[model samples]
Target: MTIGVNCGHTLHGAGSGAEGLFREAEHTRLVGQALVDLLKEAGIYVADCTIDKADTCQEYLAKVVSFANREDLDWFISIHFNASASHKGKGVEIYTYKGKQYPQAKAICEEMAKLGFENRGVKEGSGLYVIRKTRAKAMLVEVCFCDNQQDVDTYYKIGAARAVSQIIFNSICGQCRQGENEKSPGRVQEKSKEQTTFMEFVGAIARKDWKERRIMLPSVVTAQAIKESAWGTSELACKANALFGIKENGWKGRIYIKEAIEQKPDGSYYKVDDTRWRAYDNWEQSILDHNNYIATRSTDGGRSLRYGAVIGCCDPELVCWYLQRCGYATSITYAESLMKDYVVKYDLTVYDKP
Candidate 1:
């Protein structure tokens, strides 16, 4: 089946980057190209509707349907990063017209969410031109909230766009037989339950750096670390020596506070305990515990578990595996984008000392 990918209006360089809105059209263009490559790799035909980028939702979306209809494609998929009036809201949402084919739209949404994103729930669009006008089965996928920093830092920055494309490619065409045929035996091996500690787990997979590790670990432990420690400034990392953030369900641990405040509905500022966190004995244990979490969760699981399982077999690439495994990230492309940034930000290649 042929798939047309539309990068939302942000690509037309409409929004001002200074306002933090229209800054990523260039990146969105890259995202569109990435989707084309991914779809092609899956033995499917791809059309880029985002060519030359449009300014508004209406203009960009018009190009999307025009390209799809022109190609007589099977379906059109519009890729968009979402934003909310309130920054607290984040996650993935898919929209379809009110018709018999809504199930397929939901399937696409659910499959993408399998990357561990919050499900904003699928909705029926009314006036949205792409949803209303596309002759082929179409869905507008909002990968995550662009306005939310945590989502941006975690998923959007990490490559949620590409992750969503892979999911879309998988959902529309099924597993790419070539990818299946290309699977290398023993590419992914389960760790023994005994080696459940965090440091040992990372050390065990040390040969697999971010490049090699995305295939093995699927995603680096950075997300887990940031999620657990509130971006390294947490007491768990600064005080307790816990570099990898691993929160357990029923473990005895200390709680520390950093210091922050919150505004109440009454319009009063309250010294809401700024620093509340879990403490571990040391960083090594934290790393081991993190591994335990991945092993148990086993990426891209749930009703879409089969999809994740297939990717584990076929793509063996850690970031892809992680996307399939986690399947619920707010930013569908979180890990991949993050790895790109990590390599640039930390000069991580220098750390590869023998």
Candidate 2:
């Protein structure tokens, strides 16, 4: 189907937009671009209606509506971040024209709430210019309160643009299909098995400069990369270049966002929220980041504190066991999966040699 996406506000106009932990204009554009990419990838025709420069708000709204109408879009989505004077507001909400709740809008809100935001529910927005003016079934999504620190942290933690894009894509485009024949919206193709071979994975790790940071066994690193990223076929690996499922904390570099399941205190596995992963420029950077993660502590110039037991260990099996004990993943068979299925089956220990 055809859809129109409005990024909301000019870079400098729209009265400076909202400012929380991040500028609303930047976040809106980022999320809007991501949504467009995802829609296109899912085989939907998309028209970008974002106004980068507008003399007036009235002019901006008119141009956006005009474009949507001209394109004869089936739906229009206006992406924006919410703001509050007290900076205490949080959660996700959507706006539809006054009369009734739009299914797509409701669906978007539901998917967004799955990222752990409060579901503020769909509300009437007859007064909203975009909603009122668009000819198609239209909705304005207020992703989260930009003024709230907790909300901002959550937004970044779960992946700012990438996470929001998935929610919107899943809500509108449904599931993604595999082959060349495009399916209807709401049906995504299931992902296939690992695409890269074990030797290729080992070679990738071996080519990296892990000499100084060889605290974690190379074989262990290779196995975890394979298991976690599915041999470079997982969305996080392919899209974001995140090989080890490392969550974004204080990373200042690029980010890749995706939904991740986590184990709770009760040992029940639940899709906790979208995780923001550090996006690398290349696969080698991902490998290096993985190396640094398991090798040292914050005090020792590394990012983690739990993997000390595995650090400096040369045995792949021992490293896997130690990582499992450190709660690297919730799977009860995580260690065994690496040891038996990956390391042993692939003969990954050869890569650990100096």
Instruction: Give the number of the best model, judged by lDDT.
Output: 2
lDDT of each residue in 1-354, candidate 2, tens digit only: 788998877667654478778878877877886676456433356776777667887887888888788877888999999998888889999988884687777887887787788899999888998899889988888999988988888888888777887778777765532222234322322322333353465555643444665567777788777677656645677678777778775677898776665545543333334578789988788888777766543543456566788877767788899988887777666787678656775667767766
lDDT of 1 by residue, 1-354 (tens): 667777555423643122243344444444555566566433355555654445665665666678778876777777667766777777777777763346556666676566657777777664678878888777777766767777676665445555655566666666543244256322332222432243234434432443443222323454344333434434357686665433333445665544332323432222223445445676656665444444444324443332333222322245434553464333334455444433222223232333
TM-score for each predicted model, relative to the true structure: 0.46, 0.51
Evaluated at residue 42, the lDDT of candidate 1 is 33
For candidate 1, what is the lDDT?
0.51
- Candidate 1 error regions (>4 Å): 10-24, 53-59, 99-104, 156-159, 176-354
Q: The CA-based lDDT of model 2 is what?
A: 0.73
